[model samples]
Target: MLRIAVPNKGSLSEPAVQLLKEAGYSQRRDGRALVHVDERNDVEFFYLRPRDVAVYVGQGIVDVGITGRDLLIDSGAPAIEHLELGFGGSTFRYAAPAGVAASVQDIHGKRVATSYPRLVTEHLAQFGVEADVVRLDGAVESSVRLGVADVVADVVSTGTTLRAAGLDIFGDPILKSEAVLIRDERSDAEKIAVLTGRLRGVLTARRFVLVDYDVPGDRLEEAIAVSPGFEAPTVTPLHGSDWQAVRVMVPRADINDIMDRLYAVGARAILATELLAVRV
Candidate 1:
């Protein structure tokens, strides 16, 4: 059985589970359950803290895992990134009391608090600035207000938490984070192939939807040109001789606009449906 690690808490967990479930894997039934078996695929799921996912995969205790890019890099674990899952978007940045100097170089010899000590240390090192890194698991933004650190290196999603703490972000971002799929370097070829194929199908389906419609026979070429699928649009003759049925894949975000254009071009009976998975 293939073992996969998934986040147990925080912003990335629910979405990660949903994606896996949509891909036909069952997450652990009990909230506190650490391990689960998906009888259909014969795969094991391991619920883990986000920060520890990369470490577990790196050690080959799990074949693959889902985690934030920031946590994976911060853990400094030896693993290979397999895919960027396109969710849990955020940035790792330096934030200090508002009106402080605006660059990492200004924090030389200062103290920085963060849960990601390795990422902070490496980022600051690039600027030739040496700051003492005080590690904290949470409440990183509050450290600056309490004088425990001169600045805080933390994940900023909306900048709301930082602003509420009276801190302002400075310097270029240390790293941009999103959910990613990662695999152990030592994973077997069969496991790698199976997981990669399933994940690609899931990711592709997440970005697109299946669209079907009817159009006049004369307008078929124009409609096909606009509504091209991953390869080619599927077309079938309608009951009426002068009409045809068209089915294609369209990007999820462009559905409305594309539908409007197709309508203006004589498309009718348009329908949009969710895709379970798409492989090309």
Candidate 2:
């Protein structure tokens, strides 16, 4: 059985669970259940703290896991990113009291606080600055005002928390973060392949939809040129002989624009539907 770890709480947890469900993995069958078993695939899911996910996966206690990119970097875990899941996106940055004169170089020889010590340390190293890294689990922004640390390295979603703490972002970003599927280096090849395939299918389904419509034979070439499918549009002769039925797969984001273009080109009866998955 393949083992996977998922966040049990925090910003990335719910969306991670929903994405897994959409990928045909059931979760929350019983309230408060921390582990879920996928009967069809002999897979086991371990619901763990967000910070611990990368540690478990990196240690090979679990074959794979989902966690924020920031958390992964903070954990300093050796794991390969299997896929960027594209949710819970944010950035790691330095923040200081509003109106304070602070720059990346200003922190040299000063104390900095952060939940992500490893990421902060590495980032600071690149700037040739030696600052004491104060590791705090939460309320990192308060460290600046309290004078416990000169600056803080933390995740910024909308900069709301930073502003509420009377802090402003400074310098270039330390790291850009998003949810990612990752696997341990020691994971078996077969399991890795299976997991990657399933994740790819889910990712593909999220980005695209099936589009079907009818057009005159003369317009077939134009329609194909306008909205080509993954490879080519599916075309079949219609009863009128001069008409053809066309079906294609298009990115969901491009659907509206493509549909308008198709309409302008004389296509009719256009329909669009979500895709569950696309296996290549």
Candidate 3:
């Protein structure tokens, strides 16, 4: 059985659970459930705080974990990213009360507040600049106003929170982050690959859709040119003659344009379906 650690709360939890459910694994219906056993799949899931996920996986307490990339870096855990989950997205950046520092260099020897102290310290080290890093539990953006620190390093999603607090972002982003699957540097490779393959199927399903359409047999080649799939398009003959049906998978972002082109090229009955799951 594969052992998995999932986020207990915050932005990453729900989507992580949904991904597992989509991969044909059983997940606990209630958030308070500490552990769940998917007997059919021979997997066990443990719910833990997002920040602690990397530690557990790194310590070999769990075979794999899902956590924010930022948290993993801050924890300094010995875990390798098994896959990028593409959710719980955010940016880690340095901000200050509007115009305090023009760049990261200007903030040298000043106070910087952050929930992610380790990441902030490590980032500044790369620039050969060190400062007083004030660690706060939450509401890091307010630390500057409250006089705990002159500048702040924290997660910026829309920049609204920073602006509301009269802060402005400065410097290049410290780190771009999103939720990711992680495993200890040393682990059971074959078992991890099985779980990784299942999740990859879910990720692929979310990214693409199934498209079906009909066209005159002669125009089939033309229609296919509009939406050729990753593999060869599935072409089939129609019931009464002179026509054929075509089916292919296309990226969700290009579906509307593909539909338009297929129709213009003499295709009919075009349809696209949301894929629940895919293997490849």
Candidate 4:
């Protein structure tokens, strides 16, 4: 069976399990269960903390795993990103009490507290800013006020947490991170490929919707231009009329605007339908 690692808890957990379920895998109903086997898929899921996902993959204990990109980088693991899961997006940034620090340059010789010590250390090295790194498991924003560190490097989502701690973000984001599927070079190649394909299909299905419309034969080309799909729009001649029926898959985000454009070009009866699954 192919072995896989998944985040056991935190923000990445629910989404990871949900995506797996969507991709036709069986997940454990009990959150406390550490391991779940999907006999039909011939896959085993090992739930671990998000930070440890890369470690297990790199150590060849699991074939592949889902984890945050920042945690992967911080682990300095041999695993490489197999696929981007496209959720759990956040930025790693440096923060300090307002007016105390304003840029990356200010990090020099300062005590930097962070959960991801390796990531912060390497980032500081890029700027030749040598600082004492204080590694904390959580509540990094409070480090400055508690006098544990002069600056803190941690994941920032809405900046609400930092504001509550009397800290403000300084400089550009050090790193942009999102949940990704990571794989080990030593893992089973065939099984990993199969999983990758299923995930790609699910993500594509979520991103796009099917659109159908009718347009006069003369305006078919214009309608096609407005809603060209992954390859080409499907066109079928209408019965007993100078009209054609068009069908295409368009991005869900742009479906509304695309429909209006199609309508302006003489398209009628425009319809958008949800796609449950798609290979491409």
Tell me the whole-model lDDT of each prediction, alpha carbons only: 0.90, 0.88, 0.91, 0.94
For model 1, what is the error of residue 105's alpha carbon versus the real structure, in angstroms, after optimal superposition? 1.7
Q: Tens digit of lDDT per residue, candidate 2, span 139-215?
A: 99889888898788888888899889888899999999899998998888797787778778988988999999999
Global fold similarity of model 1 (TM-score):
0.95
> Of the candidates shown, which would achieve the greatest lDDT relative to the real structure?
4
Clashes of 3: 0
Per-residue CA lDDT of candidate 3, range 25-136, in tens?
Answer: 8999876999999998888999999999999999998999999999999999898887998788899888887668979898899999999989999999999998999989
Model 1 lDDT per residue over 1-280, tens place: 8899999999999999998887778788789998899878989999999999999999999999999988888999997888989899998999998667588888898899999999899898888999899999989988988889988999888899999999988888899989999999888769767877887899899889999999999999888877887788989998747899999999999999889989999999999999889777
Task: Please give the lDDT score for candidate 3.
Answer: 0.91
Cα error of candidate 3 at position 171, Å: 1.1
Candidate 4 lDDT, tens digit per residue, 112-225? 999999999999999998999999999999999999999999999899999899998999999999999999998888888899999999999999999999999999888888
Cα RMSD (Å) per model? 1.5, 1.7, 1.3, 1.1
Winner of 1 and 4 under TM-score = 4
